[model samples]
Target: MSIKRPRTGGAWSWHQDYGYWYQNGCLYPDMASAFIAIDPNTKANGCMQVLRGSHKMGRIEHGRFGDQTGADPERVEPAARVMDLVYVELEPGDTLFFHSNTLHCSDQNTSESPRWSLLCCYNTKHNNPYKESHHPFYEPLEKLPDSAIKEMGSKLFEAKTDFWDPANDETVGTGKDQ
Candidate 1:
């Protein structure tokens, strides 16, 4: 999940999802993500940007960038010269799916409207990590009925799940919590 508050949101540096997953010991690049817009996404609100067809370029080197891991600028700058930079603007309920190696980032939200999106990531069983990592290995997904979702959205429903906090995570990448 990604969220950027109005006017005070921070920028996400250029990087590929594979760049981070590679560190987790995943053997293959068989992974992808679907970003579902929860609120209106526009350029003024710092919509996601991608280097079109960048997944073909393979994974780039990544290093710690403040509280996140980012692709090396030396490699990214040259790729940007050949690839098209596309700003992904979408309405609520819109979804954008991309390969793990796709280069992408988003700027700070300087507009009055908030920008929020939910990212559902997937990893193939063949791509499971050789060693244990922060993310889990191949686990069966539990399917819930449509009625379950309807009940969860109702005011009478009480939330039962706890959100994952990155602050408590002690990964080797960025020492500071975002």
Candidate 2:
């Protein structure tokens, strides 16, 4: 889940989900993510930007971009030059699914409305990591009904749950938790 506050959101450097997951020991590119728009996604609001068909290029080396781990510009620059750069504009409730290797990023929101989204990431059993880190190994998925969302809508995340904060993280650059 991500929340880009109106006019104050920060930019996300170009990156691939697999770039991060690979560090977690995932052996294959059998992963993906579903991005659901909770608020309107527009150009002015910093909608998601994707390099079309870039997933076919396979995984690229990743390194530090400010406090975040991002795709190395050496690769991203060339790919962006030849590929179609698509701005993913979506209305509320719209969902966009993409492969883990797809290069993507977003700019800071300059609109008055907030840009919020729910990101659901998935990993296949065949590509389970060799070692455990912050992410879990393969486990049986508990199917839930659509009504589950409304049922848990009012619930809040527990404060003690050790949420991952990239800004304070010291190991994302090294691909291991310290």
Candidate 3:
């Protein structure tokens, strides 16, 4: 659940989600995420960009880049020279399921329209963290019927949700072992 405001949203540096998550205590790279578009996502509006099959490259070196941690350009630039760069354009309601290790990023939004999206991340039960952190541990999720979405409607936004606060948290890092 993130919003990329038009003309204000900044670009995301190339990186793998697992490149950071592995440091969170997850022993395996068995995770996935579903990104659902809430608004039209276009290249002009900073739609996601992926390096096809880059997940097979495994995790690359990551370090602080501006306010975010990004993949080492020394490694990523060489790969990008030969990998296929895909701009993931999507319409409202479109969904993209991607591996956690996938190398992906986005450009700054230059369009007049916003690009909002909801990302539902899932970790395999076998890949549960060894220690509790910002990410949820292995807890069985209650299955919801498809119609449940329509039933919730606007009420979903009204419900109280616990969100991760990086300011008060130290869950994000390369870990003590790294």
Question: Which whole-number lDDT from 0 to 100 does residue 153 have in model 1?
Answer: 85
Give one clash count per candidate, in the order shown: 0, 0, 0
Question: To one decimal, what is the Cα RMSD in angstroms of model 1 from the true structure?
Answer: 4.4
Query: Can you write out model 1's per-residue Cα lDDT over 41-151, one digit (the tens) per residue?
Result: 999999999999999988888987676778988989999999999999999999999999999999888899988899999999888888866677786778999898777
For candidate 2, lDDT tens digit of each residue in 1-178?
A: 7898887857788999999888888989999999999999999999999999999999999988666689999999999999999999999999999999999999888899999999999988888789767776677879999999998998787685477776554435432221
Q: How many backbone clashes does candidate 3 have?
A: 0
Q: In candidate 2, which residue ranges exceed 4 Å CA deviation?
A: 141-178
Judge candidate 1 at residue 74 and give its lDDT: 92
Q: In candidate 1, which residue pairs clash?
A: none
User: Which 10-residue span in candidate 3 carries the lowest summed lDDT?
Assistant: 169-178
lDDT for each candidate structure: 0.85, 0.87, 0.83
TM-score of 1: 0.82
Model 3, 1-178: lDDT tens digits are 6678778856788989887788788888899989899999999898999999998998887888766678989989988998999999999999999999899998887899988999888888888889767787887889999999898887635545578765655434332211
lDDT of 2: 0.87
RMSD of each: 4.4, 5.6, 5.9
Q: Which of the two candidates, 1 or 2, achieves a greater TM-score against the reference?
A: 1
